[model samples]
Target: MSRFTDFFVRNKKKLLIGIGGFASVIMIGFVVFLLNRERILKYAVAKAIQKVENKYPAKLKIGNARFLDLNTVLVTDIALLPNDRPKLMQIDTVEATVSFRSLFLGRMVFKQFDMAQGAITAFKQDSVDNFSFLYKKQAAGETVDSTAKKTSNYGTLLNRLIETAFENVPDGVNFRNLAVLFKNDGRTINMNLPTMLVEDGEINARMTITTEALTNTMYVKGVIDPDNYLLAAKFYGDNQSKSIEVPYIQQKFGATMRFDTLSLSITNKVYKNNQLTISGESSAYGLVLNHPKIADENVTVQNGAMKYVLTLGDHYYALEPESEVRINKAIFYPEATYETRPKRKIGIKINSPDIPANDLFASLPPGLFDTFQGVQATGTFKYRMNFFVDMAQVDSLKFDSDLDASPDFNITQFGPVDLRKLNQEFTHTVYEKDKVVRTFQVGPSNPNFTPYNQIPNHLKYAILTAEDPRFLTHKGFHEGAFRHSLITNIKENSFVRGGSTVSMQLVKNAFLTRKKTITRKVEEALIVWIIENLRLTNKERMFEVYLNIIEWGPNVYGIREAARFYFSKEPSQLTLEESLFLASIVPKPKQYRTYFDAYGGLRAYPRYFFKLISGNMLKRGLISPSQAASVSTYVNLSGRAGSFIIPKPDTTHVQLMDTLQLAPIDLLDF
Candidate 1:
């Protein structure tokens, strides 16, 4: 031990000298590196540009690049040109102050950034687009290393994206004269930003957007915190009279959406245990939407807001139950989940907890609920709905919706149409293409109106069997039928079937316009539910009204007129065969002529419908086996309907017989 200690003492001085020499060498090398740091950074930038050009179908050009200081860079005349297309992006000057420490770690972390006279043009003509190369897949046989690709869950991916986006946002920015142009086919939309500045996490911007319809100026102000993933922004028109119109949607999707002011705030984002949660709030004022599929007229919401908590997992994205939506003065909580794995499923639930009836009524968007616009109500109401669907098992899809009002709830004033009017005699108008085609009384006042008891049992049953077999037993809706309709529609990928019940049909015909739109359908459902649940009118009265107002043939209204026009008889004298024939044509009243051959014989399609309806009726005991078997698909046209049929050869008998024999008994038509 003593000898080792003596040896160490003798070599300690030499060891110290050697260590000091190594430290000096390292310090000198680091100083030299710091001296040439600008050149090294420029070389790295050039290499990055070369790599980008080689990988993509575009070329990156930097006219000049230099370092203003150790941590600042200035680039001039930068352009990105795609092959055989217009330039994708051009910039006059770009200056950035990067974090020197981050650069040493091979990361470009900008502390400040400034860009001026920059423009991006995204053009598409025919099948060619200028910017698609950015998203294009790698070339064939140019394999990417699987090990290099990170295995990430949905939450991880989303978190990474959010972090990257927020982290890249510089603390200070000054962007001027920036424009983005989108041109497709013959349409062009240009967005010009005159000045956008960010200082100390506060943002202010002015943008002028030009489209085919109008030019609008928008102002944006926001506060951002990159470290905390927080952002609050407000976007509004330059003036009260002007609204910011969302461009491209009108030209691309046939929808026009405009708003006076919109405010958005992202309060928090968290990722943990393979789940990502984001909380945010958004509000809009004076929002207007016009779309043919939504409504015939513009739908306007004066004020709307929502506070949302969104969660994303491996196979699902969800709006958590903590989310709340407010329209005007009414508030509702909504939850929705969309899952892609195990099975593609969607679930949505909404709960409005005992809101004032007036608030509920007032919250309805204009034009969407025109009938309820001026209606005044009192008391409180609550509504809840749960809808779930698994794409693989649509037959088992669940849709449960309920709306309840307090016992004292009452409508104080009527709107355009009163719900109680159907209980008494009232004029029912039939519209074709939004034009009044026929007007008839739905009561004893009309000579051709048929009372429920006076209508033939065969005709009533036939219509019920063909249209809504459980109309008498069910409430306003038949969940089984709706499920079946959903299954069939999903299978066919077309809206070829509707699950409307007798009550729904009555409400649609009596209280709603004939325009086939989403708004009309929702209104019809709501009205039916109200009438059925409130017992505003009896089932018999509704059925009577429905039978009296339904269109049968060309200019023909009601069962009485239909019987007289088709068979020269009254509604009570119509036979089962005649009833089925009339019932089959109810869905296609305007195309009734097409159901019969030139010889006035029922076509194969109509025969198939007759067999299907009769078979279902027999299965349900509405008709006996003998009646089902003996029901003929033939109808003698002796009234004015005869004049519309042109006599010709009958050739569908063989096909009709085969279809009747082979088709399934459970098949349905709507």
Candidate 2:
């Protein structure tokens, strides 16, 4: 170090003068560079774009890419997809400067900024839409209640996020609020939202998304009365005066309970299928439940069927014919346990080729065919639906297929056909199409299609008290119910035990074949499990469907038809005596004729079976002793005489042949 200093001292004055001149020039050059910062920035931006294109292999369509004075981006355009239209995006125009502190300290610090108009648009699937800027909440009332806010974790976290992002925002990125929208009117939709924060996976967005897929989107872009949405309930709620469109709204329900303690309620509203909905402005932490009122509301009578509207709080439920039935739609919600709703009586319409009457008759249980005195046909036929809502209401009835030409009738070949005799019995087998497939006809008491919704409530309670007491509280497949049935089976050593709920009855009746394979039973169990989560409770439509489509003899389908055939009277007129007869024979239709000697037998069921089922009903508070005693008596089971042949009118004729033709049956139970 000493040697070097001695050498430098010899030329210290010359070195000092020379170094001073160089230092002055360098400082002067730097000052000039800062003054012309805009030019340098432009050059840098151009180079950066070129590098970007070279660095990544892509064919991105870019438009109006710019760099203004002092790192300002005046205008920009980026196209993510191919379209016939052009996309424009603009940030507020302004003059700004780069922060020298950031440049030297490796920290981002900007200053001097301004903004103007900015908009973002994205189109997909023949729709147009746009996104806009946001405004902060400015309300009068208090939400946190001061004391709670002091100890709120979420409140504190929100505070931190706002503080961190704005620290280095600077004036360069300033902009006025954004304005964006989307509009479509016919079979199309366009929508957009700009400047959104998508934290985690859920979105807390306040924007509009409109589409032209329905009748109208303009009229449907706001709040609506929730009750009108239900298909069945709409008819009774003054639909004639006002009908509205709803394209972007849905309600979500939540509960914290289990069997006997099951509790549920709805929460914040969201767009359809939950696009980007948030909590109510003043929603509480927990939601309160509004259970549906069935049969308790008004019902409409139309087209020979009763139309009952069921509402859960203000939301609409299903629309179905009047009859005895069950749905698991939050079925046991009142019980507050883990239970699921099954696919039941409700169904969606489909557009498919009609099934030949002959083809449908070919699909029946092995021996069940030809067993009925005037029975007919074989094989399976089905229709294809365009869309569907496969809920409990839909699950109850089996959707075989629309009937084609009847037994020997053809629609295309029009001949002399008597319209007045459509349902009348004929000597020659006649096929009919479009006739409602069911087990019985409904009068005020029967209420076939829209029978009073109240009827099912009463009937279900009765049936439940008469059948399974635990139906309301258990999941679809009740192990306890199963165990009891097994014990009974062991005692009697017979397959006369069934712990299946009304839901299970619908399943086995509608879908599964008559085979007693474990695999098939397993499938039934699984479907029942699904029903527990997805269906409603008891329904009148369900029972009506069960009775109408069920066979009593050859072609004897519904309770209406059966009532007329057996008693020569309307179903509504059949007293308790006749109703019990119907219930007794249902469990074993094939054996009905044999056991009753043609339904001339046990008006009541087997000893243990009746007690077990009836006891369950009693425990559930479904029936009175009078009702039980009335159901226990037999109207005409006076002797062991299997003379249960369907009654025919004097005008009705039956053609007998070695190979007699009969109507197909839907004996859908084991």
Candidate 3:
């Protein structure tokens, strides 16, 4: 060590001189690079613009690029022309700050970008959108929200080049007064950003969207985490006079919906393990769902509040489990959820407490409410209902409803009716294709009109047993039939079969058309209550009217006409087998011709259905076991119309068929 030190001491002056000369040379090079920095920045801008133009059919222009400092570059008066359009995007100034450390690695990395005073316009030309590059259509066999791959190879290269241009944006990206215009088909929307600050994977944005065509304006402000797509902070939105136009809503609900003023506030919080919990409350005023059929009675939610919840990645939003919406005097608590599990599903349950009948009537349009013009109703009724759909198949639907009420109701036109005075005749109109054909005299007009006593006992029993076995016992409705029919209809998502009692059917025929609408059903139920509880009609009177007015064939009305049309016989002479066959087609009497085959015999299904009804009758004690056995397993309809003869019952069989007791009724049970 002493020898090395002595050697260095001898060469110390020369070594010091050499080190100073090397340092001077590096300093001179730095001075020269600093002087020519502007030239290098211009060259880089020209090259970037040229590269972008070569990839896409867009032109880029910049008035000048200058250095604000050694670490910052400012570009002024930039304009971008997409296709042949003039200046789709215009910016007054843009500044980027470079990372000094990245310069040592031979890369120009931006630490921040200030993109200010920019205007962008997007429009559709033919079938192509100006900003179509932002979205690539999904290929076949993909879900609706699935991510799609980028379309073009040039897009991939362009994206890489863009990423490289701004490699290290560590601090933030800021925007000021950026105008965005969008036009597509027949709609024009304009949005302006007042300010936006993006930093550390979080963004706080403020914007206002407006449309002159809709007379609407939407103001939105939110803090979002783009990396995880979370609302890390908060979001608030206000939409005023936002008239939404949706054709499907008009078709489905028979209405057009519009919101006059709406406000929403939301907050997102992370619980544990990065689980996101979002809660929000929305309120709207002057909302209307306008329907043409109810021109004067639009369904409206003048002002209402809704509370909701959403969990990220679960693809579902839930409403308050117990929340009530009060429109006028009616209050309904509805629980609803819409979910996505690759496929979509929906469920809704509504429970309403007792509501005044007059309040409900006032909410309905005159076109519907007038159907019960002569009935006086005074009371409250409560009902609960549920509906569900899974995987877009309506077959998975389940709906259940129940109504409870105690009303002081009656028919104004007819005072409390008397069963003994039912001998009076009346006129009725027949409807075909929803139009009245002719006013016809119904009761007592036909010479073959049979009295209730003269009507064959087995025929009466068969109709009662097939249609409604609980007819004499039930005051107005049969709970068992209703439940069964409700289940079937919900499973099919259609009202294919009706579970109406004889009393209800009689009222429907006497006062309403067979339109199968909710309005019709409600009115029918109201009328049934009036007739049963008010004693406007008795069980025997309703059954008699149902028999007289029910459709038997295309134009055939009543059992008397059906008997003559099918067998050229009187209603009193219909044999047990013939009566069963007649009862089988009561639901679709107009299509009865189809039940007969080419050989003019009752088809297998019709015969089997008859046996089913007959078997039920035997089980319910409406018909004797022997009487059911006597009916042939197969119904034989001769080819010659009206040639099938009615078989007379033996003397022993007549007494059994004649003496069957009527079901005892308890009117107060209603």
| lDDT per residue (tens digit) for residues 251-271 in model 3 | 457677665555554433333
Compared with the true structure, all predictions reach lDDT values of 0.83, 0.36, 0.62
Arranged by lDDT, best first: 1, 3, 2
TM-score of each predicted structure versus truth: 0.81, 0.29, 0.57
Ranking by TM-score: 1, 3, 2
lDDT, candidate 2, 1-670, per-residue tens: 9988987999899899999999999888678756755455545445544443343222224344344644444434433221233342443433345554343333324454443444544333343322110112213231212133222122233223333343434533333444443333333334333332222211222233445432221111112222221101111101332222234322222211111111111222223321222221111111122212211111211111111222111112222222111111101011011112342223333332344434333322222222211223232223332222224233222322221233342222111322112122222222234233333332344433233332234333434444444555655555445544544444454765666666566555544444454444654654454344334324334344444444554455555555655666665566554554555455544445532323333322332234444444555455577765655534553222225443332221221210011100111110
After superposing candidate 3, which stretches have Cα over 4 Å from the reference? 1-317, 338-347, 372-377, 386-400, 406-427, 441-451, 475-498, 529-536, 633-670
Output the worst ten-in-a-row residue range by lDDT, candidate 1.
661-670
Better of 1 and 3 by TM-score: 1
Candidate 3: residue 594 Cα off by (Å): 1.9
Residue 490, model 1: Cα distance from true site in angstroms: 1.5
Clash-forming residue pairs, model 1? none
Clashing pairs in 3: none
Global Cα lDDT for candidate 3? 0.62
* lDDT tens digits by residue: candidate 1, 1-670: 9998999899999989999999999898779868878766776667757666767777789888778876788989999998777999999999999776665654456788999999999998886788756644446334333245434356767777788678779989999999999998988889999999999999999998898887889999999999889999999998654688888788788999999999999999989888999999999999999999999999999999999999988887999999999988999999999998788999999998899988888889998998888888888989898988898888788887778889988788868878999889988888888898887777887888788899987778778877777777777988667767666677677876777888998888898887789999998887787678678898888889888888888888888889889889988888878888888887768777767886667888788778877777777677888888899878898888888876545557775764443332224433
